[model samples]
Target: MSDITNAYIPPAALTGSMRDFRVPGGIDLLGRTEGFFKWQNLRRQNGLWPFSRATEDGPSTVCSAQDDSGNKMRGVNFASQDYLSLSAHSGIKATAKEVIERCGVHSAGSPALVGNTSYSVKLERKIAEFLRMEEVVLYPTGWAAGFGVIKGLVRSADHVVMDMLSHSCLQEGASAATNNIYQFRHLDNDYCRNILTKIRAKDKENGILVVTEGLFSMDSDTPDLVGLQQLCHEFNATLVVDVAHDLGCLGEDGRGHIGMQNMLGKIDIVMGSFSKTFASNGGFVACKSRAVKEYLRFYSAPATFSNALSPVQAATVLKAFEIVESYEGRAQRDALMANIVSLRHHLRGAGLDYYGDPSAIVCVKMGSEGLARLVSRRLPELGLVANLVEFPAVPKGAARIRMQVMANHSEQNIVKAVEILKTARQQAEVEFEDHKRPAQFEARAVA
Candidate 1:
């Protein structure tokens, strides 16, 4: 999190706030406004801004919004992480149907109590194999995996050194452990190395876990896995990577970024989500060591207290994995990347501001929170939908429209979506001109 005091703002020569606007709230409102203005300016500086609206509702198509008249909108979803188009896959549906027929719905109790079944074991084994781990533990959600893994692994006396921009789960996990925490600058290898050096000298005997994400969620940037892995090895620190955004899309055979970066054996714990790429709900943590797996099963709260995934969800994800492991998987992965490249080219050609290496996810920073939300609301008017990130999720003023590409989005659909964005940009510019004050005031002549 950026310090409120040190937050970046745009040059006053750029966008200026209306001094006469009557704000309903007091200092809180003013502070919020200042933060928003700052965020907008900073995003503009980085050339990252956009909004999301609704589009279609099918596999390989984007869904941006749903209008009040039961209509869809114009925005192409650049905000979804549904990489494999599994949400609408027939195979997934059929497998889920089979599970429903065989086991009915909902686990009757938590897994540690009574919800355990052969299905659970089967799913766990499949997940472990898919990620090249010896064992895997399931969680109710991706956040749960992060939280539980941290709490389960780190003791009160231990320290956790993490990336500054790590997800909430990583932060919460560290908090759950102890106050002995060190956060390195985002994606800065030198900063990470310095932290490791400091930790080695200051807390030599203390247990340490170095955590980072495989692909950063907001910016779609990948960490230097080779450097990080080497640093972890040199410092004798356990390395954990959350591949929530990179699984099923980046790795060879969709194993994940760890494998993609060839950091497989070097990484100690691998965490990821099924909700995004797998088109299912749940989270997982995989490790090569059986002892770590056993420890997590007993010590992890989400694993012990929470119910296992329903038979249908388990079946659905299991089938999705099968597709991911097959020749069809290669086809889908290529299609997904192709779409990603096409959309990226469109955005870049249009001179739209965006961030990170173009892959599955891209975030467009829309100058200000107001503009970001306005674009979001307007995209649906054009028949599209996307996610608007602001405040706590991102920075206070660093709002953006985050977009995700899927294997299903067709070339025609991509063209249509880009055309809509171009049109919307023109309209937005016209409105901004109509509402904005003139650049200079003319000298009043005596009548």
Candidate 2:
């Protein structure tokens, strides 16, 4: 061998070794030892810590479940939009079962082409009557209905006015048509009027479609329906109210927001989801006139291409709707409200940072990605699962967890969840204050 002093190690050999070990700081002798030790510690910490897994493998609370080391952790299902607990209802199940037995699985064709099942037609008629409209069209999903209705009604020359916080589907459907889409402040009728006036002044020939939701899903707030309807009429704008979150939970008879406000005649188009109150999958666009119905049938792409609601799905949703329209149906809605009020009182009394609105949905504003993740992990340990929404779903710094109140969840469950939230927030405050990052947790402060 040549003199040892002339020896050299190839960079490629070192790189290969480093890649094998995955040592941070590129595997300098001392750094390699430190990195391995750090890796081991992290592995142990992660192994012992709470990670949600959907499988029935670990202790679960309201928000999390843990599987094995290599599996994806399961999230507690507070993110679901099922409001009336209809999906789990016995009557809906029985009806669906019967339909499946009688009509088979799918309708197997598009409604416009050949797939107009008897159940689908009846459901549409029932939905129309429920919304106090003369004609309605069914779609594959609520988003499909939303997309079809917006794209069908608005023209390139028309101005579409939507709530700033409207769903992505509504925004996308309108935006795809033209850049003339105007978004007004959430529930601000005055803003709507001013924008409509401006649009009418400059483009008299253009039509205006004023769109809003019966319930603002995020904040659990209601729109100023009476005021909005008045503005729409005065400005020649057709009002389209999307009742996805409110269909089964609001209204006296659970007919939805327009029913509660007694503005059924004032609204031009009413769209809703069967997934929520009806306890099934599909959506409908209820309108007062056959002309609009005929136009929607011919023009709406979603209605044209989307499969007709399966016979089973239609039957299930119809049964749920029947329940919703009955006296007992009204009781369920009232019970849901009672639960909401009880939850609001409990959360406020516990100094929890919940939105506390008197609606079907409640939001607990937890600040920071780290804290939201931590709480989400801890919540399941307490036996309650909720949704931990972080950046992108909301704003960067405004992470929150949303919960929907259903007739299925008991007062005890609500109270217990609030208690756990209080304890969790108190623990977080102590930890974050010690770490000098207390400002990252304003949600706890709001509590």
lDDT of 2 by residue, 317-410 (tens): 8888888888878888888888778878888898766653577788888776545544554555555566666545555656676777776667
Q: What range of 10 consecutive residues in model 2 has the weakest lDDT sum?
A: 9-18
- What C-alpha lDDT do the candidate models reach, one value each? 0.73, 0.72
Clashes of 2: 15
> Could you tell me every candidate's TM-score relative to the true structure?
0.81, 0.80
| TM-score of model 1 vs. true structure | 0.81
- Return the lDDT, model 2, position 39: 39
Root-mean-square deviation of candidate 1: 7.9
Give me the displacement of residue 19 in model 1, in angstroms. 24
Model 2, position 280, has a per-residue lDDT of 69
> After superposing candidate 2, which stretches have Cα over 4 Å from the reference?
1-79, 431-447
